[model samples]
Target: MLRWVILAVVVVVLAAGSTLLMNLSTSPGTSWNLPVTPAKAGPMPKAVVEGELTHEFGEMGQQQTGKKSWKLTNEGDADLQIWKGTSTCMCTVAKLQKEGDKLTLKPGESTDIDIEWKTNFVTGDFHKGANIETNDPDHPTFPLFVHGKINPPVVVIPGDTIDLGAINSDEPKTVFVAVYSPDRPETKITEINTSKPDYFKTDVESMSASELESGGLKAGNKINLHVQPGFPLGTMREEIVIHTDHPLRPEIKLTVVGSVSGPISVVPDRLRMVTVKSKEGASGEVRLLVRGGKEAHFDVAQKPEKLEVSVEPIDPVGAKGRYLMKVSVPKGTAPGLIDGEILLKSDLPGVAELKVPVSFLVGAN
Candidate 1:
């Protein structure tokens, strides 16, 4: 009986060991061959703007104004919060329908965003955009495009203003501007007037077919302007007014900006004779320089039939273009203000004539 009981106990132990090995190899929690279950994903916020991406304004003028609107909706189950709306250009303005400090839209809600553009002080093809900032993860930033072509009544070739930056006074420069109507092909320029006619030489001519094509127009007139020398030394600004036959735009104004540098410059253009010398006539010397970077030859012409003047080369043997002028007043001249001028006439094209003033303050010696 004892042997049988011992044998049975060993059989039970062997069975228990087999069960432990099977549990470790084939259990779902510890088995390496089992598939992993993925975690659940939550819903996300989505921003939706329904409309045309680009708003085009065809043939707009400076006097024209219009607005464009877009529908903004939150299609997702989460909240859609708009941070701000920013305009890319000064001529464009963007805002929400109901403006406030902060803007928020609930799920399934909609709102309108209006973008207004003013066609003032602009021309040619223009493109601008308005940026929308939101809390949507998919679309953090949205761009609204605005593009158009602005056609003015009259298109000024090159530009409305003529800028002849720093130029030598001895070199006359010429520029041409064409004025034509794209809307009205038969538009004509009746008259062209310059505020300072003495400074500018104007000539009018019809634009050729090739010239009109180059300016991207069907018809136009070419205005030739020659900037003359002898403008008062310093900065100069002038206006050119054009009279056209167009009913809406009858008059157009253009500006000319430039600075003239004198080729033949006189160091003290004015001579002040203070008093007569004790022994001899009051003598003074004036210097002249040729700034044209070339050989200069001139003849001195003095005013007042009796004024005594002498011209001498600064460097008699050198290649520099410089000269000195000596003037003397008679000792017995009467006491008063005697005004005179010394004129230098040269062969240079731009600096052909130059004048220097001379005055005598005759006092008792």
Candidate 2:
């Protein structure tokens, strides 16, 4: 009876150990060979605008500010990243509710973008634009536009720039501009000034009713600009400032852009010494003339080396000032280029100095 009892206990112990080992090796929660699940990708970002891309502000006035708003919506599954971009001009700017340059929008999110600009003294139609950069593949760059006409209290016909064209320094140039206040016609010219006092002078006259009617002005003045002959040679970019008694339009600047030709001039502006044999050398000449039959005294300075220069007065033909300048490079010169210039200094004001570039290229024999 003792042996049978012992054997039954041993068999029960062996069965319990085998069940525990099976559970440890093959449990669903602790499996060693389970398969890995792949991750699914989310949707891309989408940008949608609710209204038109352009805004019309009608007619705006000077010193006034204009503002427009646009709704930007993100119709996507993933987050939308938008970067702020530059506006059309410095006077115009775009702003958002947030302070940072980068803004994120979740799915089905929307925000407002505001564009503000100030009306300057310029007249006529104006168009401004701003850009919005987005991560959306379909819509990389979104453009917004604002356009309108600007009406100032004071009106200048033919715009703010007065082109004098080509001006001869020996003769005076005159141009006319009509300045008037459409609403307040009785605006008087209080004072006048200019950037170049020696070259610019101004005169104003009241516009006749018929004259005003022709120009579509209610009341204003016809400004006469008498540009004297003392302006320097080359190019002149000057300004004329006018002061009015009207409170709304007190001052306005008129730009004068022109090219002035002095009494002294030159032909074949640049002397081409070109390529020549080192043994043969090269030679050239330039014809110099003073317009209006005016006599000039020029002293040549800063002449290049390995060259000879001579200035001789030509025979007077029809009361014209003319001269012959001769430049010569002697034979047996080195195989190199002579890099220098001849600066002609004049005794007349405004015609101070003239530069002539010398390109003396020499080839080996």
Candidate 3:
């Protein structure tokens, strides 16, 4: 009986030692108390899109669109959920070959997604991408890029829009822009004209070697926009049309925008109030300040019925050239957009009248 007892003790000790050694040999943090049968991986979704992640459409026209189709498959044992995701500007996903907004692909199942991009929005070597969202744990979102050279034939470096910024109605300013052709170096500008000849003058010059290199073209011209003095006050946006000899694009339009100010100016040039509770209504304030050591007295020349306007000196005696103009929407005003102008008459020099565009939206909270 004693020998048997000793033998049983030895066997128990050996079993304990084997378990400790097994736990030590296994990965760190692994437990020895798990179930007898090892746990197997559960069913999970997988998202896979076949082919190269990027495709180049080569050189194409500005107005033309580039399209491509991709095949997405579910190689996993579970169902896959796919939906459209955000895409870059000027790029969109066409109606899927599949019929639903969200698609379900079983094991070994596949679907096709069509993507289209507009080249006219940009020029030169352009790269745009779109995203595909899925329920796959491995790949929650997949990204694909479309590459192509946009042949605007005539390319404008640094955009065609020139913002003159804040210019005194009496001050003259000048801006220059570059226009060239990546396809042909000998492109010529036949004629250039400004919509408002009274305020703008145009001239063309041969682009320097460095300018041409920076424009990524061998030939092009630089345009000088001379903004003359005494233009109308308030916001000024003018168009300068350039007639080019390019057969594809006969003309290019440029825009010059800026605010022209007189001695008197109003802060919050445009007053806007949105989501105003119709029951309570709302109002906005505009600060009128007269520069150049001058004073201005304001009166409401004209206003819409939906609006109530009032003018008050910022400080009746201490402040000399500043006032507060308040435009309000009455409590009972209808629930819609109130788009109107508040014509103001001020005593400031050279500004016969001032128009302030006011927009208010009244809604039920």
> What's the TM-score of every candidate structure?
0.45, 0.41, 0.50
lDDT of 2 by residue, 89-194 (tens): 5434444434347788999998887778877775778898778889998898888888988877888766689998888777888988988876566778899899
Each model's lDDT comes to 0.74, 0.78, 0.80
Off by over 4 Å in 2: 1-60, 63-149, 246-249, 267-288, 291-295, 298-365
Residues 1-365 of candidate 1 have per-residue lDDT tens digits of 99999999999999999999998888887846778798636766689999776777666666566678888899988888875566676434344533333467899998786677766657788787677788887898778777888778777777779887875675577889987877777888888899767768888888998887786767788899988766543345679998999876899999987765686666776687666543355877887777744666767754654467776678667647788877777667666667767766777656655566787776755
Better of 1 and 3 by lDDT: 3
Candidates 1 and 3: which is better by TM-score?
A: 3
What's the best-to-worst order under lDDT? Answer: 3, 2, 1
Itemize residue pairs with steric clashes in candidate 3: none
In candidate 1, position 83 carries an lDDT of 53
Better of 2 and 3 by lDDT: 3
Q: In model 2, which residue pairs have backbone atoms overlapping below 3 Å?
A: none
| Per-residue C-alpha lDDT of model 3 across residues 278-334, encoded as one tens digit per residue | 889898999888776567777898888888899988876667778889998889788
Off by over 4 Å in 3: 1-148, 190-197, 213-216, 231-243, 259-262, 279-281, 292-320, 330-333, 338-357
Best candidate (score: lDDT): 3
